[model samples]
Target: MSKLTMPYQCLKQCGNLLIAARGSTIETFNLESRSLVSSWKCPSSKPLVSETSAQEEVTAVESPAPAEAAPEESVIPPVKRRKLSLSETPAEENKNWKHNNKGKNHRQAAASTGLDSPAVIALAVTSNGHHVIAVTSEDKSIRVFENSYINLKHELKQLSQRTMPKRPCGLAITDDSSTIISADKFGDVFSLPLVFQETPIPSKNETPVPATTEADSVLFTPAANHLTVHSVRNRKALENQKRQAKPKPDSSGPEFEHKLLLGHVSMLTDVALHTYNGRHYIFTADRDEHIRISRGIPQAHIIEQFCLGHTDFVSRLCIPSTRPEILISGGGDDELLVWDWENGNLLSRADLKGHVEVVCHEHGKAATDGSVDGLKIAVNQIEWIMVGGEDLVVVGYEAVPALFVFQLTAANTLQHIQRIQLAGNVLSFIVNSEGVVVSVDTVHALFSSSEQRNMAEAVDVQPLSTFVFEDQRLVPGPAFEGAEQRHEVPAEELGRLGALLYGLENLRKREGDGRDED
Candidate 1:
């Protein structure tokens, strides 16, 4: 039997350290030495139970056992049973009803735990490099970890964990590192504090009961009665309503301090926070092919402008630090879009499908899998980096084993430079002063066909690849010395990796006339 290796899903670089997430673990490596530094695994989904609480439960059960073992002093006399009225029920009956309701609630809570194990889907580092934020899939939680790189710690110290109501697809930290902005698939964006503080519980004496007014003290009666409801069906509904217990107000939202910034009618795919002219702005892209710009923080409700040109879902957004006014967006479209976001103008579109077709042909696969008309390109990432003293743009596509490079022209257009082919699909990458470190899926886990996946498994492939610029083109760089260590992945967990790593394809709309698109 062969051991299965886990593929990296996310990568982030902080100074001389590199953080990578694969499976449910986060590993940090020292880039200078090219050695693994530390690893931290996410906690389980089961709620934690304290030792004291468990002891108390055991004591309660044992205390009842003693009473059951007690000997009877004398023969107990049989008490006369009292007949109950037709309108009243026995106490045992009510107890059974409450027990049944409790069981139903317990089952519902268990069902929502989901089948997949917790896997880190997204990662972000604070600008100060003092903290790291990770988002997990199973619990939909945002976790904060203290970065203690100077001390050479063995594991990251988790400071806090706050679960969100919906799964967060994108995460960004403010420049000041005081707040975290998260965009979810439910079409809502929320901001949370970097360090969460638990709300203190107040004593019963601290809470004052409200005084009853004259109207509150009076008995309430409804105007609708049997006479008002003429039909038999209406009267039956009225009786059922009266017998049913009133529903309680929902309190399932997050209890921590969080504020809603802005929302869209379609699912949000990415979010970016930028500061231009001393004012913070938020740029968001959605599956409905809409790019929205809004004022940050208190003024987030104000809509600045919309950059709309693509006819397909927009999955990635990039705002170059060198060119803040230029926004690059890509998704299900065959071309990459260049936009002057502030003015809501589409500067130019670069052809990406042609390059993808060439790569697919070389790999012995058709660009179109017979499901779509033309070759569909899902851009996974768009990053700006300086290579050979020239500003360049690097783009990676989902399930494509290649990285496309282009130069941003003075006229605000993309000029093709070079293409760096790899052995497997590009999962994620981080660019630094040294070179580019890419996390590749050598196992072909993202591929849909079984034949392609089997062929990839037959050959041994490296999970991490490196590249450097030479003569304005990408060339192979020195291998990361100690960063090639692979972690073993169990067979059972392989089924869930598809949901964690391959999600952009789910945004594709089916052939129908329906308004809703999943």
Candidate 2:
């Protein structure tokens, strides 16, 4: 109680990054230094807790605590290595991606799993990897947690005191270590500088920079309205970036210095930094089916080129690490397009249309895990892209959300290697050198984004009543009466197929009987 109480006093003001899940899974990894630090694994089923301290203490005293006695399943594991900085040695990341594959594909169901609710909407961790921030689906508030013991298997000290707007989506911990930027479904975003009542900075324009620091800084998606740069430490350059004009209240809300970027009419899909020739460029994708690149600047300069090719909405987009200038875009048309981010030219393209067609947003859908509306996702939003030890880690949704591990060859094409299945559809994912962190729809079963996709294990689940299609004719089942109308399938062939089904069903029943007799 003392440890939990202490962090709350100052946790709100510190800038710590967060990794969250829709309901499937939540993990924290330092983006500045790519590595996983902590994870929240939901239980397999709800459990009953003994309120008495004696019971709780009994579990902790054990050398290796029983997995069931886990105080809070959302456990924060100790980070063995310092977070890998993007600018640091790339020998490791480079070695694996150069090879066709890196880590062997793998997937496992979460240890403890239950109904996906109280879904994690947002996540944040501190620069030093000591603190954690999480937003829940039910309340839409931010809670702070910290690591207190280095020797423990898990440590999370909660420090949340208030709630923010409901359904606030994107969250970023600024480099200045004070401000946190979050976006909601309405295309609106908020800039809260630790413990402050979210100062509504207007939503008619684009979201400005979210944080400030000496090294790598993260800002809101410039595709929307309002930009606020708030840091804990006083600075000179950012001070120059602020508007001299005073704050004025509008009929609806307060005004901000940086006007929102109005160019992108689509739902802003993703935000990433392109550090090229010693400068950083910001890139964005929207529902308007366009990808826009920003002039390399803290405030960003003129809108650069727009990459176009998709017939429908561009759902997912990323810049593969191996090919820095090259960008990947997945769309509603079930196609993947690669582009040259520099000149906005089409480089190489592929069609990923093997799955069922009704599944939309395989790449872009604005949602959080475990929420009612957030759980209805058919496809996953493009959450995180990591140069898997050797392959590119693509964490996304299918009919449900999932994470995928693939390799790119010298041909600069995606080589389908292994697929990982998740319990819930993958909503978002993040990767660093430590581990791959993924946020997914947790309403169903939960599996890691790193699982091997055994197509044979893809569960060609047999229906209770088998319907076989032979010679393009549907042998209708007994369930549908008078359904033999000749739309395309012939009646004799249908009967023959029915006979085939009867034979199979009988054979299955006989096998069951034989097993019982044995």
Candidate 3:
């Protein structure tokens, strides 16, 4: 039986080390030596119990019991009785009790998933190369690891892990690497300290609040009785109010220190931090075609401006270090947009659909007469690189087996340069001093068509591919040694693995206009 291979979903380059995330495992490679340095997988799902707590519990149990105090005068309190109400009948009470229990059981089952493992969705490395951060899916956690060189070899030691309130879709670290900015699908952005700190437990000597108090009873008291409300709907609402008067359990948010930086009405797709004139600004893209520029950190609430030109969802944002004033954005649009983000101006738009069509034709996935319609394009990544003193922009689209290169003109416009074709769909890529290292899904084709053939038979495919610039043009470089190794799984798991690599197209909204968006 054919086996399924897990592809790399995230890639980062820090100094001489290259980091790649495949499923729940993180692999670090020495770029110069082209060898795997270390691998770290996500921790187990079982919660860790501290030894101190365990010992304290044991001491409490094994220690001698307090002497029995002499019983004071046996005073029997008088029993207070009240008449049974109509709604308090034993049958009605039992029915309500059963209903409540069912709801509670459902909630408990949804909250815990047993031993489901987590997958790494986002990865980052500090500029100093002292730490590596990764976000996991199942637990909605941010994991930090110490990237240290010990025993004559590199190693990744987990430092801390903190669960977030929501699953983060994009992550960005501050310029100083003091804080982490996370954006979730719920349209909120939060900033957390890079280092995790445990909250101190309350001292036992402190006074504890009473579980029940006289003032608490007032909350359950209804405002209107049967005398004031006579309508059927009002009576039904009153009954519901009485049924729901039970005290609810406290559902608190995350205990860790975090601040709400900013928010959007639509789901955020990407986030980038840029510094200009010694002032840092945050660029956030969303599914609503908005590219908002806000102040960094403490002033994140203040909106600077919006670069508005995209007609579809914006999935990726790129701010070149070489050109801080220029902002490149792309997503479901047919063209890549160039913006002067500082001034909120649209400088130019470069054709992306034409290039995509060219690739489809080359791969025999579209008609030869140039009549391809209902085709969707989503730019997954936009990266900037400098080759031979010239600024170049590399763009990769979702499910596209080619990397498009463009020249960033002095006028802040994009000019088509070249397209480096690959054997499979590009998942992620990182540019380093050596060249470009890309992670791809070699088992999948660029697009689906009636004439589409098996990709493995049509072209040579590999999990990892490399490219380098020669005379201002991109060419295939030497293969990355020991980097192509992939974890094999049963063929039945291919659908699950493919979903993790090719989900950018899911951001497109369907309007039911009889048109296929992706």
Candidate 4:
């Protein structure tokens, strides 16, 4: 089992380093040594009110503007206006700050911007492993940082940050690392530019334009006489020409630096970007059991196709590094569906219902149920791993909370090869070329019960599990070993049982004969 001090919020393997988030802190560990290399905490953001300006801010809040009375002619009073949103409150209004304004008031904005705790919930590493992006809990923002996995000090430098309009459910970085696509709970996918250029400096001799004219000045002046003197027929043609020349307004607006890539009716669960046959395609999974394939860039709204075999909310998606054409997805369903997504064909379906049997120590064997909450067999997590020059799919189920490994056959089918029963429910996992690192729920009732009984003595505790497959068997780490199975058979001796039976029968016959004579 892997040793973890706190519950991990997210985990990603970058090169030989393992990056993980625990609450507001991010830690980097040397994968080879399995030791902590570095750790960084999310800096607590405070409001811009400094000690010098504290009195001014307090005075402004204390003496608020008087409420304006409604006109007597109106029957109902005007509805009260809501407070300004975090994005509306500017940070250093007179200064040209590099960061955005949404994180100005740390306390009030924290609720929307997640600047207070800034706990990372989702993480994605670039294909080159030089950069990483993380989504903060409740902030609706994506933060890009330099991947300093090898260094113990100066581990990360904030490169770019984009605030989303809604909480992000999933995040994916493009293969080229030029753009990042994030799926939000509001059923929208947006793209943010990773590269930036410095703002151009204005010429010193040029004067700044005034933002507004005097209040008494007229806003709109009539057109010149020569411009308005065209005949009705000619004017109609000119108006039509002007209308045709005008460009349509793009979804990319001035309010945000990011552009809306696409949208779905139901909330999205995950998104993945892949390059196939020299073309880029984006696969998005939603809560309504819909998986959509679309163009990755430049008019991403065009839907290419849909993979619609799932019956429940699709929560996870994976495309093997070796097999980019195949897509594996799992959701509330008991089985996993492997698809040739490019052709919209169901290559194979793997049902894990009857194949898995849980050995519960307290109950001997766990009972099965068909209900949603009572479901004993359900795929909770799926990952595509390339191990020992072979492509394998790592799956975790809630039934026994065990891990199962399946090797992709030459015919594009899954073959179960190994299984590992975990002590707790599997929450998340990260698989790399070396081995699989699984994060499980160690505080479950059954697992914690043992701890409660053995608390008096100091002992090492591991909240996560790590396993490696060797000879088609799962072997735990050096800290633990698999329990051996033993069965006892009833003992029996068969020396004179037949002779004893014959003697007993002879005695019964003699007793019958004596009774007849009497």
List lDDT for all candidates, in order. Answer: 0.78, 0.42, 0.78, 0.62
Q: Pick the winner on lDDT between candidates 2 and 3.
A: 3
Put down candidate 4 lDDT per residue, 1-518, tens digits, no spaces. Answer: 32223345367888877777655667776676676666667766546655547655655666565588657896763444335444434656423432644334332222232224566768888878888788775555678888653544438667756666677868888878778888886688888877544344468998765344454233333233338657888766655554432232466533546788899977677898988988888899976788999997985989988999987778778898788888999876757889989778888888765445433433344435422234334455688876667788888654244678888877888888777776655556788665787765432323221121122221233544677667545688642121011111111211111121111111111222321100
Candidate 3 per-residue C-alpha lDDT over 286-389 given as tens digits, one digit per residue, 9 for 90 to 100: 98899999998789999999999999999999888888888899999999999988889999999999988888888777797864678888999999988888
Q: How accurate is candidate 3 locally (lDDT)?
A: 0.78
Error of 2 at 452 (Å): 25
Question: What local lDDT does model 4 show for residue 479?
Answer: 26
Residues 141-231 of candidate 2 have per-residue lDDT tens digits of: 5665665556744446564334653344445555444655554433434555543333645576867654445332333223222234345
The C-alpha stretches of model 3 lying farther than 4 A from their native spots are: 44-116, 199-251, 448-460, 512-518
Report the C-alpha displacement of residue 283, candidate 2, in angstroms: 2.3
Candidate 1, 338-455: lDDT as tens digits: 9999999999999998888777777666645523335577999988887666778899998888899889988989998888888778889987645688988745543341213453
- RMSD to the true structure for each prediction, in A, is 12.0, 25.4, 13.7, 21.3
